[model samples]
Target: MAWEQVQKALKDHLGDSIYNLWIDPLECVSYRADEVRLACPDRFYRAHLDRNHLATVQQIVTELSGNDCKVILCDKETAILPAAQPKGQLRLPHIPERKSVVRALHPRYTFDAFMLGESNLLAQSACKSMINGDDTVGSCLYINSSTGLGKSHLTHAVAHALLADSPQTRLRYVTAQQFASEMVRSIQSRSMDTFKSVYHDHCDFLLVEDIHSLQGKKKTQEEMNELLDALIKSGKRVILTANNAPRDLKGIDNEFRSRMGAGLVTTIQAPDLATRYRIVEHKAVQSGLNLEEDVISYISQQIQGDVRRIESALLSLSAKATLAGGAVEMDMVRDVVAEIVGLSTNLTTTLIGEIISREFNVSYKDLQSRSRKKVISFPRQVAMYLGRKHTEESLGEIGKVFNRNHATVLHAVKVVSELCRCDTSVRRQMEILDRKMAEM
Candidate 1:
C-alpha cells in the first residue's frame, strides 16, 4: 500500500495522539515485499521507535503490504546549525532562544479580551469551539483576512485558549516567514530531517501565522506541503492564518494551496461602524484610558476598517493625555489623529457620498440605497469613484459605503475615468468634486 494509505491506517490503529508523537514523522525511504526502510529524523526518534513501536509498526506494514516486510531504520543526517554544538547552544544566530515551545502568543490576546463583532463573529465562534474541545470543529481551520483585521490576534487567542484548556498540550506557533526561514536554515545545515521532526513530530497543535508569506518561495512551499500532509494524516490539529483566501493566494503551489483549502475557511471582514466603536472602547479600556463616548465615536469614525489603527490611535491619545496631565478632549484627539494618520480634515466615504448626493440633488440614502435608477446611479458611481481616489479605504470599503462590491467600485471608477477622458463636462465636474473634497 501507499505510504499515504498506510499513514491513514496507522492513525486509525494508533489513534491521533500516539500516531502524531511517534509514527507520523517517519518517512518511507524504500518498501518491498521482503523489506522496508523507514527514515527517522534523529537518534531520539529511531531509539523511541526501536524501543517501543517497532513491533507494532512492522505488523501494520505486513498487513498493509500483504507480506511480512522487515522494518529497517535509517537516521537522516542532522545538525540544526552549520556545525554541531553543545546541547544547550542556540541553533540560529539571529533568533533568540525562548523557554517556551510555542512562542509569539501575546499575553493580552485572549478569548475574553477579543471584541466580538459581525465581521469576526463566526471566525471567533469557530476558534472558541476548538478551544472548548469541540471535536465537531475538526482538526484544521483557516482564518483569512486582510492586514489589521485581527487574523493574528485570533490565532494567538487560539494558542492561549489551547494552553489554558490543557497545560500539557504540545503546540508551536510560528509565522510562515519563520517556518520558511527555518527550512532554509535547515537546508543550509543539512538538517532537513530535524526541521521535519520539529514540526511534524514535536508539535501537536501547530498555529502558523501569515501563511501568505510563503507564496513565492518554492522550496518553502514544498516543505510546508509535506509537513501539512504529515500532520493531517496523523490527525493533528493545524491552524493557519493568512491575509487572503487560499485560492486567492498568487504564485503559491497548487498542491499546497489545495492542502490549505482542505479545512474550514473563515474570513474576518472589515468591521462596521458600531463594531469599530466597540473595538476603540475595548482597546482604550485595555490601555487604562477612559475615553468619553464622543472621543470613542470620533476615533471609531476616523480609524474605520482597521482594528490595529484604532488601538494605535487610542494608545497615542492616552500617551498624549498622560503627558499633558489632563483629560483627552476633542481637540487633543484631533491633533493626535492628525499626527498619527495625517488627516487634513474629516474626509470619509460618508462625507464624499453626502457631497455627491447634494450636488446631484439626490438623497444620501438613495445614493447608498439599492436604487439602480440612472439619476441615483450616476451619482452613486461618482461617489464610489471619488471615494477610491480620495480616501485610504479599500475597494471593499468604498463598496460597503455605496452598497456595492469591489468589482462594482472598480467598474464605476473605470466608467468615470472614461467619462473624464472623453467628456469635458464630466471632467470639469470631477475637478470640482475633487477641489471641494480637498477643501473639506
Candidate 2:
C-alpha cells in the first residue's frame, strides 16, 4: 500500500514517460515498518536506479511511511533473501543463460544500440513492454515494417532482454520459412507429433520473422494458426514480423489474419531527418571514422530509407578514406551517395519543384505562382529549401524557378529550416520528400 502511494508520487513528479521507462519496471518485494525492498530486473537496472534514483526513492518512502525508512534495491534473483540477512551475505549475480536461437543474432542489435525516433518509438516501446512482462501489452505483438527499418533489430533486442532477465525462458527465434521447412521435414519423417509438441508444449516464447512468406502456403498457415491458438491460450508470448500488416497480407486466410492482428500491431516508418542524423553519427562513431559535421549531414540527407544503406555508405567511405590515407571529405561522401543512391549529379531546381508538387499535390504552376495561401506558399518554401540543399544552384537561380527573388528564396529557406527544428509534422514531411527524391 505504501509502495502504491510512492509510485503515485513518483509518477506525478517525474511524468509518465520517465516513470514508465525507469520506475514502473521495478517490483516491490516487501514493505515493513522500517524498511522497503524492491527488486530490479537485472544488475544493470539495479545499478542505474541506485546511482540516479535510490535517494529519491528513499526520501519518498520515508516521507510516505512517516518514519525513517531504508530502501533496499536488489536484483530479482536476490529478492527472495530474508530481510535479516546481512548485505555482504547476498548471493552473487550469475551470468544470464545463453538463448537457443535458430539464427545467430547480430551482436550490436541490442536495445541500447537501437536508435529511437518518432517513427519507431511505438514499436520499440511495445517490444520493451513485452520484455518487462507488462500484461497490458497482451500475450502477442505484431510488428510490420519495410525492410531495414529495425523490425529485426527490435526482435533481436527482445530476445536478448528476455533471456537476460529470465535465463530459463524457452525462446524459439526463427523465420517463417524455417518453421515451414522444419514442419515439412517432420512430416516426411513421421515426427509431426514431436514438431507440434515442440512449439505448442515446449516453447514459452515464439518469434517468427517474415510471416508474409507464408502467404500462399495453406498447410503452413493452418499449422501456424493452430500453433498461435495454442500459444495464446496457454499465455505464451509471441512476436511476429512482416513487411505488410495482417489485413493487407495476400493469400492469407481470414482466420490466420485475425490471429496475427489480435495483439498490438505497430508499424515502423522511415526514420525522419533528425533520427537519420543520429543514426549516421552513431554508426560513424562505431566505425571509428572521424567524419566532419558537414559530411555527416550530407550522408544523412542523401540516404533516406533502409538504414543498412547508411552503414554500407559509411563502410565505403571508410575504405576509400583509408586507401587515400586521409580524413573523410564531402567529395568522398558525394561519390558514395551517388553510387548507392543512384542520384544524378545534375539534380536541378526544376526536378526539385516537380517532386514537391507531386508530394504536396500542389500543381507546379501553383508552386511557381504568386499565391500567398498557406497550402501553396508552404510547399513553395519547402521546394526552395530542398532546392538549395540538393542542387548547386545559387539563390538567384533557384528563385527564378519559383518566380521569386533571391531575397524571397532566402527567407523561404530560413522559414523551412526553423520549422524543421520546431515542428515535427513539417520535419516528417521533409523526410518523406527527401526519401521520394532519393528513390528517383
Using TM-score, give the best candidate's number: 2
Window of ten residues with lowest summed lDDT in model 2: 90-99
116-176, model 2: which lDDT tens digit per residue?
9878999999999887778988989999999999999999998888777876676888899
TM-score of 2: 0.61
Tens-digit lDDT track of model 1 for 1-440? 34665676667666799999988888776755577778898998899889988876775565444345698887866322223433864446443222125665689888788888767888998887766657776778899998888887888888887777665556677888978877776577454554565566556778899898887899899988898889888888888998889999998999999999887899998876566767888888889998888677667656666677777787788888998895887899888777767784568787677567657878666887888899999999999989988899999999998788899999999999999999999999999888866744
Q: In candidate 1, what residue range of length 10 has the lowest lDDT sum?
A: 77-86
For residue 396, give model 2's deviation from the true position in Å.
23
Instruction: Quote each prediction's TM-score.
Output: 0.59, 0.61
TM-score of 1: 0.59
Clash pairs, candidate 1, are none
Error of 2 at 429 (Å): 21
Best-performing candidate as measured by lDDT: 2
